[model samples]
Target chain A: MQRYKGIVAYDGSGFSGYQIQPNGRTVQEEIEKALGKMHKGKPVSIVASGRTDAGVHAKRQVIHFDSALQLPSERWVKAVNGLLPGDISVMQVDAVSSDFHARFDASGKTYKYVVYTGSIRDPFKRHYAAHYPYKIDIAKVKKASEFLTGTHDFTSFCSAKTEMEKKVRTVTNISIEQNTDEIVFTFTGNGFLYNMVRIMVGTMLDVGTGKIELQTIPSILTGRDRTLAGKTAPAEGLYLWEVYY
Target chain B: MQRYKGIVAYDGSGFSGYQIQPNGRTVQEEIEKALGKMHKGKPVSIVASGRTDAGVHAKRQVIHFDSALQLPSERWVKAVNGLLPGDISVMQVDAVSSDFHARFDASGKTYKYVVYTGSIRDPFKRHYAAHYPYKIDIAKVKKASEFLTGTHDFTSFCSAKTEMEKKVRTVTNISIEQNTDEIVFTFTGNGFLYNMVRIMVGTMLDVGTGKIELQTIPSILTGRDRTLAGKTAPAEGLYLWEVYY
Candidate 1:
């Protein structure tokens, strides 16, 4: 079987998360179903870069699958996109070495969270961004983000129910871009723990609102306790922007 | 009674049209319903700048209504928006003179039509733009649009089913903006015949595709026959961009 790699984009609003479930639909289920059709009803399995939570969109999520069919790269993209729903699309596809793995071979990742800080909700972006009706001190948030950059123990930012024992991750970069009433927070890291990006954004928002001191981020990181972090941001605002390999 | 003017925005995907009908829902029906709720079912009527065909959006549709309720401009905007559906929104409101009219007093209007010219359909913009898979010669379209600008007998562009006898209209400006895979056509005119803008765009598309010759536009206009023009473009790609008084 030849292995194929692809970049997929999806609006995750209709999904019950990326993973397959007994009830409701999923991105994986749709792709696999499409693959099954391409394979003449034989079940085909595929692996994605990672599982995005429900309501979290992806600009380019990577994936890999094996197939005996020998369609060209562009044809695979067209065929898969034809079978997928309107909310999910295959952007590009290419042949990959048999040894290549979508999840394990990933070198880094980037994610973006969009926050709309407007008094009244913007009708155009209502479905894509998180609406925060209060003003945010952008400078304070930037200062707080500085503490989040670089290699550190991100256990405090992770979800409390996470089962992973190793919470140390290397954060490569963090930047906050403010455009009009929307604030976009981009995070690039070697890897992320469950809910880490959302928790970090929540804590930074707390700093912006003066609820958490800007200088307290280092202490919170050192604390390595999820309770020290602020509440998790909503999933709709988060996007899996890129997967680097 | 106080006369109030407001700027409204709507997605128009769910609306049947801008005019009220017995069996179908429209933007006019929604706003009037909202107004009735505010007036305790007193049944308030409003007039818009003009009617938008079904599936045509409005970025800033001007509307006027006379109300007995004593509310400030901002309050009227907020209250009406609260009562309106999520697809429709009131952007701004102001008190207008008693003699002011939404339809009759308007001197000009601007409409925009969006076309996505890419091999792959953009799922995100599926609701907002019309997708054209074939490539278009933009320079040719620009050349054709030049002939269409200024005063002319636009009978060839109007819908054949239209009841109006006076098909002449003054086209003040026409501009085309291309960005990435999308092209936007903006039309500012003193007035437009029924389906005039759509027919013009369709003819321009034909010119861009080499189906219609550039020099044929003037002759087509002189023909003063609806059958001589290109087909009417779909309503989903059209937007009432602005109205001038």
Candidate 2:
């Protein structure tokens, strides 16, 4: 058996999440189904770099799977994409060492949260961004993001429901980018907790709108309390932009 | 009663064109229904800059209507937008002279046709662009476009069904702009005949692909025959970008 590595891109609008659930359609389930069909009804399993919440898009999600069927790497890319849904495509495929694990390999990840400040929802951008419909001070948002960079216990930015007890994560960098109709916040880190990026974005937006002070982020991180931070931003605005391996 | 002028924007994917049709849902029908509902079943009429074919989008389509209800321009914008569907919106509203006509008073218009040049369809841009999965030489497109600018009979570029005897129109400018994943062709002209832009784009794309010679453009324009040009480009790629008064 040979292991294959592939890069996946998905719209995420119709998917429940990346992982397979008992009752809902998901990104993982769709790809596995496609692989099984390619192998003539034999079951296929895949391991992904990580899970993305419902409505969260991904530009390049890494995945790995082992198969006994022999096919050229380029053929594997074409054959699997043809069997998959329109919203998901295998961007690239290659053979890899059996020891190379998609999730366990050393790497970092980057995410972007897009927010539109327009009063009325833009027809073209409604599906792509989170509409805030409020005044935001860009200076405040940039200042708040500075405090989030570096190693820290990100309990204040993580989802309360996650079973993981370790909340420490390293944030390599953070940036707030301004566009004509939207402001995007990009976060790069070694790892992220559940809902961590969205929570951090919501907290920064609160700072921008003066709901939370610029100085509030440092203290919130120090306190290690989820309730001390701002709301969890909507999942639709989040994108798993890249994963490094 | 006062005459009101407005600039409308729509996504066009859910529309059956801008005109009122008996069968399919049209953009005009939706706005008229909204106006009728606002006026308590009193039918309200609207005149547009021009009719866009089914699946064609608009960025600033000019329109005018008379209203017995007096409200501030801002309120009119909000109330109309609230009543309209998510795909359509009144981007701007203003008071205009009673003699002002959206179609007759217009001097020129600008249209943009977008074509994506990628092997795989971009899921995010599927609704917004036309997928052309072929190699297009940029230099050939630009050279062909240069001959299309300026005044011409334009009978070769127009649809065959138009009853108007005068096929002569002045094209002020034509530009081929290149983007990373898409190529946009912008046209500015005093007026256009039915399907004029799409037919022209099809002809130019053919020239770009080497199916037609660059020197043939002049003879085709001189022929002034609909059959002399290339196929009609798809409607979804066409956008009425701006209406000039």
Candidate 3:
């Protein structure tokens, strides 16, 4: 069997999430179905680098699958893309060793959350950006983001129903960039818990809006309670930027 | 009566076009309905700088409407935006002179046509851009574009159904820009005839693909027949970029 790795980009508006779901559609199921068609009805299972929630977009997502059938790399890319919907695209495909896994072998991941802070609404960019019409204090958000970087217990930043026992995760980098009319928060980490990035973005938004102080970040982390942090931002503004190995 | 000029932007994928049509929804009808709702059942008529065909988007479209009842600029901007669908937005609203008009008072108009010439598809930008997925000769298209710059009778470049008696229009500037994976054709003119920009883009595509020679542009213009020019490009790739006073 040959192992194949591919990078995908998708508009997650119509998807339930990255994982397979029973009732609603998911990105994983759609790709698998396309792959089955290309492989002459042979079912193929794919493992993704990370699972993004419903309404979250992906600029570049990595996935790996194994198959006995040998196909040219270009043909594989075209065949899979031809069967998929217009909202999903296979950006790149490559042959990899069997030991290379998309999820388990990944070293780190990066995500970007875009917030449109302009008073005027942007019709074309509405789906990809979160509209927050209020004025933001950039200095506070910048100071707060420094506290979020490095290794820490991120239980306060994750959803309460996380299944993992270990709530500690290493956030290698966290940066807040403010443009003329938009605020972008980029997070790089070894791994992320359920809703961790969204919750962190929400808490930073609160800091920028003066609802939370910069010094409260350490207290929030120590509390180890989801309620101690700000509300989780909506999923539409989040994008899976890249996966590193 | 006060004449208010507003700059609008819309994603044309959902509308029949800028003009009001008997069948299907139109952008003009939707905005008029929103205005009536905001004006306590009184209907308002809006005149736009130019009429865009079905599925043609607009980044900045200038329009004007007259109303005897005084309304604040912010109220006009906010109320129309609140009532319009998510695809449409009123970018700016300003009170104008009573004699001001949207169509007749315009000195120039600009349109941009984007063609994606990449092997891989872009899922996020599918609706906003046209995909060609073909190798193009940029030098040939650029040479053909220079020939189409000056004033000429644009009968061949316009649709046969156009009813204008005078087919002569001056093209002030015509330039082709090649980005990393996309080719953008921008045209600035006194005005454009029916399907003029699309036909020009299509003719340029033909030149880019070596289907037609660079010298054919002058002959096509001299032919004064629509069949002599290239096919009409899809409307989704065209955007009414701006209108100059």
Best by lDDT: 3
Q: Calculate each model's fnat, 2 decimals.
A: 0.22, 0.33, 0.86
Candidate 3, clashing residue pairs?
none
How much lDDT does candidate 1 score? Answer: 0.89
Which digits, one per residue and each the tens of the lDDT, describe model 3 over residues A127-155? 88888888788898888889999899999
Q: Between candidates 1 and 3, name the one with more favorable lDDT.
A: 3
Candidate 3 residues lying further than 4 Å off, grouped into runs, are: none
Q: How far is B107's C-alpha from truth in model 3 (Å)? A: 2.5
Q: Judged by DockQ cut-offs, is candidate 1 incorrect, acceptable, medium or high?
A: acceptable
DockQ, model 1, C-alpha based: 0.43
lDDT by residue (B1-245, candidate 1, tens digit) is 98989889888777889999987889999999999999999999999999998899998999999998878867987798889887788888788899999999999999999998877766666667888767799999999999999999998999888898788899999999998888899999999889999999999999999888898999999999888888898888999999999
Interface RMSD for candidate 3 relative to the native interface: 0.7
**Candidate 3 CA-lDDT value:** 0.91
Expressed as tens digits, the lDDT of each residue in B86-171 for candidate 3 is 88999888889999999999999999999988888899878877888888999999899899998999999999999999999999
- DockQ of each model vs. true complex: 0.43, 0.45, 0.83
For candidate 3, what is the DockQ-based docking class? high
Model 1, position A101, has a per-residue lDDT of 95
Model 2 regions lying over 4 Å from their true place:
A22-25, A69-73, B22-24
User: What lDDT tens digits, residue by residue, belong to model 1 across residues A19-94?
Assistant: 8989878999999999899899999898998999888898899999999988887898889888988878888888
Q: For model 2, which pairs clash?
A: none
